[model samples]
Target: MVPTMMLVADSSRDAHRREALCDLADAVARRGEAPVVSSFGTSDELESAVASVDGPLVVVPAFLAGSDRVSAELLAGLDLDQRFDACATPPLGAVPSIVGSLARRLGQAGWRPGDGVVLAADGAFDQDERQQLTSVARMLSRRVQSPVQVGYLDAWAPSVGDAVERLRRRGQRRVCVASWQLVDGAGHERLRELDATAVTAPLWPAGVVVDTLLSQHRAATARLAA
Candidate 1:
């Protein structure tokens, strides 16, 4: 059997967080796959458990929910020279699962073709990342008929508040703030602080879209196995 490393940032305490992680793992495992979920957090006591597994190590600092402390520490711990002994998958970018997630949320909330949405991502200080996030938003907007805007917080352009203001000014009252961040990352925290009255919070689809994303993992793992 070939050894493979898998990593997940299980950052939050919510059942959704745990379920999302487990669902991905179970899906992968059911396909005869085993991966090490490299975790970093002081809360759940799961990080230490994951680290002890004697296999190839792939670090997945939970980028789902914004990990301020983990990010700072992660930056210090990172290496560009393929320094880790195992292959760590590039963290989830804006993927197809995102679109499915959005559709589910918007549909449940009675979103129509013209409803406004903003897929909020972690605003990166790096200009390239900011552009990448913008592209993701654009792509998603096209995928769904509803208008989707890009929202950010610190360190990026088109800040969430600004995105909201722009859309509101444009006469979009039924706006959905769909968070594109993995799940528990800073984006979620920022998302939580938004005015629900102006922007619908039904856009938090982290819990809702886990199964669809799990299928993505299964497909990737199957491809690897083949």
Candidate 2:
């Protein structure tokens, strides 16, 4: 039997977050019409969401690369040891494979290696999650090979504007504002003030990022099932 799976996200904002939520639900629903749950506000909602299910439960955490504790908090509210056998796919925003994926997407979108890029994310205040996001930034920066900086749409040290100004000061002619926002939330509009040369869009470089995320989710959910 298919284990009951809960695809958890930080509410449905818009692009990828929206994509992830829809994909996970569809994946589970297609499997056998399993329960696909979401927690929008706090981690607490996850409890009620998960409680609605029976049998083995799988929690598919929704996060992009450079992720913060947003997912962690949502997961923490879950009783992993007893309530369900869980496997967490890290925030897609932080994975190196994701960077490669994002790079490929940008390449298709006329973004070259030296295009000054700001990998903007909606991060968290938790120290560990922040560290994880920082680690992801480090890994992705290597792939960028030019000037790739990390900034936040909400939390963290440097805001997006700060990152953009610094990069501009450093003589970056064309900057691509790649958002880690997967949801179609209001967060995407935050990039409106670019200096005409800055290309603003989702962090996705191409379709491959979405494909890889799905593959990884399946692999992880399978591992948890075992």
Q: Quick one: best lDDT, which candidate?
A: 2
* Reference-based lDDT, each prediction: 0.52, 0.60
Which residue pairs in candidate 1 collide? 9-62, 64-183, 64-184, 64-185, 65-184, 65-185, 65-186, 66-185, 66-186
lDDT (Cα) of model 2: 0.60
Tell me the tens digit of each residue's lDDT in model 1 across 133-181: 6666766777776667777665556887778778888998767777655
Clashes of each: 9, 24
Candidate 1 wrongly placed segments (more than 4 Å) = 8-32, 42-76, 80-85, 125-128, 184-190, 196-226
True-vs-predicted CA distance for residue 215, candidate 2, Å = 4.6
TM-score of 1: 0.65
The TM-score values for the models, in the order shown, are: 0.65, 0.74
Minimal lDDT window, size 10, model 2:
196-205
